[model samples]
Target: MKKYLLLLLIGSSFLTACAQDQFQRTSKGTMYKNFTNNTGDRIKVGDIVTINAIQKTDKDSILYSSYKGAPIKVQVQAEGDMMDVLPLLTLKDSAMIKVPTDSLFKDPHAQRPAFFPKGSSLIILLHVEKIQSLQEAMAEREADAAKKQADEVTLVDKYVADHKLTVITTASGLKYKVVQAGIKPKPIAGDSVYVNYVGHTLEGKIFDTSYEQVAKSAGLQQIGREYEPLKFVLGQQGIIPGWQEGILLLNEGSKATLIIPSKLAYGDKAAGPDIPPYSTLVFDIELVKVVRSKAAAPAAATKKPAAKRTTKKKTTTKKTTVATKKQQ
Candidate 1:
């Protein structure tokens, strides 16, 4: 009985080693070893898969690790060489794929990374976390964008409350409080206004200013052009929606502070290297002057009426007629 049991244990160990050594290769020269069974639901095309992956060169130098941050979300397709392995994965599946570097940089227009040398292998360790339909993924993205906007709004509301600011909130989400109510002649929608302003983030970092002294002080001056008030047409889209709406609320020479939301400013997209996405902006604007657009003159003021056609009554020619008859 002891001899029979020993032989059976040896056979089981051999089978286990064979199972662990099993690996598959795709036609494109991708070698993948699946550590998990594929008995669960499989990933399909058009499905959005969320994965945490760590990529490395053949030398084992780490290129990227999504485990350090958010998992990468991708739509499965059989086209891209890198994405070919995605269709073979299921939720909670883990695998390691060795892809030829040349295959990825095959396109002449593609730029290869400098760190990855030619003829080396690209190692990928992927873990598929979740799977969802394309429609579901799109819906989730929209919900996330909306939630971010809501959070921004809440933040602005908190700032307003904390400061005990008395501001006028417009229908379009612009908040303003007039500082110096300048002379009459409030700007209207069609006016061209020149404003000296300083724009900053909520943290009070000045990004832009129209005044020379302020620009010099902030070290943001532009060479060759003298600093002066920025002139723009009111209600025009030439500037941001917030500036257009807020400038019209003040009169000539008026000074006010505008608290603008991201929707009215850059809106989820970063403006530049300085401004991040979904940032609320603040501006201390002084309305230098509000001049009406040249074309804004009243139509009737330049119109000319048609000249009246006058008719003179025929004069009596009796004296002349009699003189001609007498001479005849």
Candidate 2:
């Protein structure tokens, strides 16, 4: 009877050790599943699909997922970007796949632990909810884009209507021109425009101006403090929207005085001590010449996309900021 009791104790010990060993190994398996692939589309190597998936890592972490009530659209072509299930695309929708650790995305951008210097493995559990074709995908994208544009236009129109500020043209149909009777010199929509201008606060403190453009043009100086009339592809966010909108209404050699309200101009932001917050700005603008495109402007020329309303700012501000090194 003592020997029998000893045998029972040993058996219990062995069983407990095996249970612990099973618990330590982090493998992929599903806790729950409720998805179906009804579309029977023959998935090719380049097919993109909307999948609702969840991923877990060896650190006993559930790292990534697309199972947030909405199906995530994923391109199979971008499979190499992230891994875990790329090497094996065996299971389709409604199937819970246990992914091994060797198939995770190898990233050059991840931090040290995420990208182990010694390298690590990841396990994944996936659920694909739906699939779509390339054309169908493109149509969905276009529909979303159209909806966004419509929404933006509606909001902008409502704001303009409430503020009574939708009149964007002068009597001569020029938006940016010298403020004078019957002399609406303005820039046109499709014309390449050049301009000299000055910016100042409503209190009339000068901040920036193209006044030195004349001295530089006259060859009396190697460089000037002000920028010359520059060229850009109009309507391309190459310049401030105010300048673009204003310039689009002016013809060649037209001039204008643009009085920009705080909101339309740089609102609630200190451009410098020169421009205070909530300042209604003003500019004496001129449209120097309207031509075809000046040239393909470099990335530096139109680097920053504009962030303000353009009553028309002629964007011909192309004065080279970099100076050539002169021999000492």
Candidate 3:
């Protein structure tokens, strides 16, 4: 029985080796096929290469493609065993790699796309286009970022001038234009206020809002989360600093536009995947209602008793009139 078990194990190992020999494989079990053998300069560590990559699933559902725009520049580094193929590619070389989804993402807790099913596979077709030094890539990216920042500043200034807005600039560099006046009682610290707001980028792309229609139009509606005004305490750290400062200036029922610069907004850190770093934001806000302090709230609650008493008196008169008619 021991001899037969040893023979069975040897036969299985032989068949596995034969199957692996059919494709170029990484030590971690990822398989690849080289489509072209261009004798161009091979990739090396510390080299930044521009490559056109298309990622798809076994069902041919394309997840990402670089054909629409410029190829992505990637630095060849040892991120994982599957990434070891990056140094084996030459300029103008093309290859397709098949990777097990579970093996690629070994961490069970890692977040994945909703479309990517477990125990499935991914196919990546990559073509190396060009190569550059690490220093060159960094310098180019920095230059592009600086140019983008300058252009954004110019655009914001032009919009302010074209609209002819009479905006009030705060000491902290926040610009606000009040469209409509509100009641005399303005909100103060520790007061709870309900606000309706639409937040957008400088380019007029709406990111978020408290309006159902706006969210629906933007294709950002969440299931079962009905849209309504947001309520928070004023002058607390419950919200962003720009919101705290801007909302305090408006009274109840006021409508205003707050133009917040990067420093007063998210600054150099990104708020989410959609909001880039150093982005300027705009908010159209309406102060809905303000809840008074605890001491004043009791007084407001006391007035409700008088209102209830008046309603009771009216009901009693109607009942008496009906009884008198019945007797007649």
Among these predictions, the greatest lDDT belongs to 1
lDDT string, candidate 2, 119-183, tens digits: 45443345554556677788987786566546544544454466454345444322233453224
**Alpha carbon lDDT of residue 204, candidate 2?**
55
lDDT (0-100) at residue 171 of candidate 2? Answer: 42
Task: State candidate 1's TM-score.
Answer: 0.69
**lDDT by residue for model 3 over 201-269, one digit each (tens)?**
877888899999999998878889878999999877758788889988998999999998777788767
The better candidate by lDDT, 1 or 2, is 1
- Model 3 scores a C-alpha lDDT of 0.76
Models 1 onward score TM values of: 0.69, 0.37, 0.61
Give the higher-TM-score candidate: 1 or 3.
1
The residue ranges of model 2 lying beyond 4 angstroms of the native Cα positions read 1-42, 53-55, 62-72, 78-119, 169-243, 247-328
Rank candidates, lDDT, best first. 1, 3, 2
Please report, in order, the local distance difference test score of every candidate based on alpha carbons. Answer: 0.79, 0.51, 0.76
Count of steric clashes across candidates, in order: 0, 28, 0
- Per-model RMSD to reference: 11.1, 23.1, 17.1
lDDT of 3 at 249: 94
Return the candidate ranking by TM-score, descending: 1, 3, 2
Name the candidate that leads on TM-score.
1
